[model samples]
Target: MPAIADRTDVYLERFNDALARFADEPTWLLERRKRAMERFLQLGVPSLKHEEYKYTDLSALADGQLLFATQLAGAEAALPSYAAGSSSDRATGAGPQVLGRIPRGARVQSLAEALRSQPDLVQRHLATIADCEDHALSAVNTAFFSDAVVITAERGAVLDEPIQLVFGDGPTGRLPRVLIVAGRNSAVQVVETYAGSGTYWRDAVTEIYAGQNARVDHYRAQVESLDAYHTGRLQASQERDSYVGSFSISFGAAVARNDIGTRLNGSGCECSLDGLYAVRGDQSVDHHTSIDHAMPHCNSHQLYKGVLDDRAKGVFNGKIFVRPDAQKTDAVQSNKNLLLSDESEVNTKPQLEIDANDVRCTHGATIGQLDSEAAFYLQSRGIGAGRARNLLTYAFAADALERIKFAPLREHFEALLLNRFASQES
Candidate 1:
């Protein structure tokens, strides 16, 4: 891998050349890609100095010394001998409803496949959401995006299952761009997961369109090899009376960064975001989120929790912006961190920017160690210290798990989390 001293423009040129290789693509979209490529050249990797990225530094990842999966691995071979403890099973939920939001009529279009079937739609929304505007890496994705999942839920439709995007670890450096569109008055859930035993740098970007009166549940889970690096952006928008519930649970990757934002453009809209990150060993995870309230009578809530140990580090930066016309907006943001070891560290901040006078918004953050008293109480009940700590941490994360509207899926998630606790303790 070339050192950071190499000009970023070199990578930009490579990306441009790759884009030129796609001739069948639309001209407008190609121009858009070129523009983003220019932007990427101007802005390479983000550091802690960026306002939204002040807590996370992605330079080491930009250097790209890490390995990447070049092809999807064997399916049966990826299966675990037993459930729960195995890497593959841990990345999946019990039963079929694990990602219970894709409706029967909705189509699943993978970019690799979309090129032959739904080329227009793919070009329309591919780089549209996280566009190449903010970060240079996003431009890299826009310039050279290949595989993506495209889903469309008709208006007034209610899906009973979550759309699942299973990424077979190809060779390292895999960037998957996924797009989802929910019609007006429709309700759906979509879950994007990263699993497999491959050591790869995973780059993902998702844009979800929640039409007027539509409701959506979005979940992004990362449970991959410890040698991997993950970074992604989730951008969503709401129409009049639309609703969105988004949760991101990350338990993998040596270095992972998540940047997600939702914009409420409709009156009477409700949006909620919940995130849970568990890091151990020398891993570092950072999550940054923003809820933009642009209309009146909108309500938004964000809650994030992190558990770190063994020199692991976690960072959370949540911001809620209520526009001037967004009076009557109700927004709340909170971030809680648990440090299991003296060497573990966490940086958390909850920010609220309110321009409306008649709005009710609050933000708070907390970072602390385990409750010694609670551990002792469990020990007094005959439970071992390790088990007691695991139980407490499980309880701490239970609320977030409970937010899942489906019962079977929720139970599966709980089991997954509990299994992690048990393994860490053991």
Candidate 2:
């Protein structure tokens, strides 16, 4: 890896070289890209000393030489078969592809198209919710992203079918961007699937804007190559009486880091964040989430669980903040981890910072191996030892899986969990 000081210059050079590709873009977007590039340079690449990234290292990403993907190659193969009939909008490393029918009351288009057709709407929401000043990776994404998938749910529009987005990695690396805007009283669900091969890196950022009384459900599944590196950020802003549910599952990549943040910007808003990560061998996964109760009468709940085995490592740090003016705020956060091997390790921290006097908030974390008694009981029922352990692990993960209201996505994850554990049986 290059020295910490050189990393900034490397990325800066790349950013400068990438400006040629955006020459045809509008002046405002060009300016935004420049500003994001500056911020990325200012923050530089994070090291172990950085408090927010202390648990996850980015050296591998910084050391690699990856060029920005500029072509659409092999994206068709990356699209999932299950999403065939779903809203036909898919995004590959090159950009968004419109092949299938879109549900009513929703507009799904590529970011480039949206910028041209709905400049006002795209400008109003893009880069407004996610903070780039403090997040170097997000800044990098904002600066280098070639194209994005934009999904807009019109006012009072109820989308019956979920929007499926597939993002494939590029030859070297890719920066994937997604923006979701749910208008007043609108309801929609979005499912994002990331798949790629080789040792490429995927840096992704997703922003969700939920208008008054709107409901947005988001599901993200990352199943990249085992030798790849992935870092993603999900940020949501909720207006009055809006509801936002976010679920994330990670099962691939050598090193993966996920950051999720939600801001309750209006009263009576409710936010729920749930995540599950299962890793084996030398893989590592880290998740950091923050929920800000900026308004009174807002509620937030978070539950994140991890399963680690065979020297794998996992980290979960969740924080909930209730501002001084957020009276009657209610928030709960929990992080749990199950280690399937003696060599596996996990670090969990759940924190609550409440300034409001009349608010209710609670946070807790747990890290432990599978219950020996539970495994023993299952084995005594004529089940093999390996099968008993696998069953216990599945049961521990079922809670979060069951919370997924989308039946198809939930079933997909369940199958992944079963196959993941069963394949490793002794």
Candidate 3:
């Protein structure tokens, strides 16, 4: 095992190459990029010794030589059309390839365009919500991300249609970024989908800001190739009387990690976090979430469920915090997992930290196999053993899926879940 300092030379070279392409950007942005790169160099890739990453290993990401997707030509061809036949506005790398009818009072554009046209707006909210200084992956993204998708809904605006951001695979490591801002009393839905083939890495960061009385529904679906590596982080901030719901559905990747963190900055705010992940074979998935109640009269709810088969591995860690000033805070969190095979493994931890004396917080975690009695009952009702097992597996995951309020998005995920189980039976 080499020292961590010895492993940063390759990333330093990549950062230098990235700076050359971003030379034409504004002085402020260029300076910020340089600072971020320096931060990454200071904090090399986390090793298994790191407490936060005890179960997952990222040695391949640190040691392997991967070309940045920005440097590769004709990489768009590798991206699959996951949103085919959908009536949603679409945006791809560096630009919006397919333009749909963007609702009135909403602005959607590429990060390059936003930086050039609305520099002040982009600068004010870009890295404000996400903590790039402390997290190494976020630092890498801030320093090396080629382009991003920026979505903004103005005050009192309501967008009934969803905004879809698609990231396709090419033969290169990719860093994708998304920023969404919802103004006071506004409402909007944003969906992010990742699909690709071949062996590569996708490191992504999404930041969302909801103003007073605003409503933002964010969804992410990761269906990359089984040979790929994926690491994603979602950071959200809510103001007084605001609402934000985040749903994550992951079914692909050789190894995947999903981190979600939200802060309730004002009173009378509500936050909901829900996720469902189904994995088979030797795939591994980890979900880590944190919800902070900084002000009084705030409420948060979290539920995460996983279905593992074969030799797949799953990890879930959820934490909720209530500050001393956060009186009248109400929080509830639960994690439940179902194992389809004896070889499958799960590690679950749910935590609650409350500094306030007048707060209600509860958390629990459960990991177990399917109910033998239930399976036998289904089998006795003329259903085959395999069919009965599949039905029970779907029922175990239905709770998290039902939390998705959008009809079309919910239906799409339902189909994906069914297809996944059907293929396993075949």
Question: What's the TM-score of each model vs. the native?
Answer: 0.87, 0.93, 0.92
lDDT of 3 by residue, 37-89 (tens): 89988877777787778887777777435434323233443333336544354
In candidate 1, how many Å is residue 376 off? 1.6
Give the lDDT of residue 106 in candidate 3: 86
RMSD of each: 4.7, 2.8, 2.7
Tens-digit lDDT track for model 2 on 1-426?
A: 346658667777877888998888888778888888898777776777888788777876663364342232444434444544444435433564333346788888777778877899888888878879888888889998888888999999998767777666443237888899999999989888777766667889999999999999998888877877789999999999999999998988898999999999999999999999999999999999999999999988888889999999998888888898999998988888998899999988877788889988888888888889988898787887777777778889999998788787788777666766565465
Backbone steric clashes in candidate 2, count: 0
Q: For model 1, how does the per-residue alpha-carbon lDDT over 57-92 read when each residue is reduced to its tens digit?
A: 666655444422134343322322112222322222
lDDT of 1: 0.73
Candidate 3 segments whose C-alpha is farther than 4 A from its true place: 67-82, 86-100, 170-173, 423-426
Location of the lowest summed lDDT over 10 successive residues in candidate 2: 63-72
Enumerate clash totals for all models, in the order shown: 18, 0, 1
The local distance difference test score of model 3 is 0.81
lDDT values, one for every candidate: 0.73, 0.82, 0.81
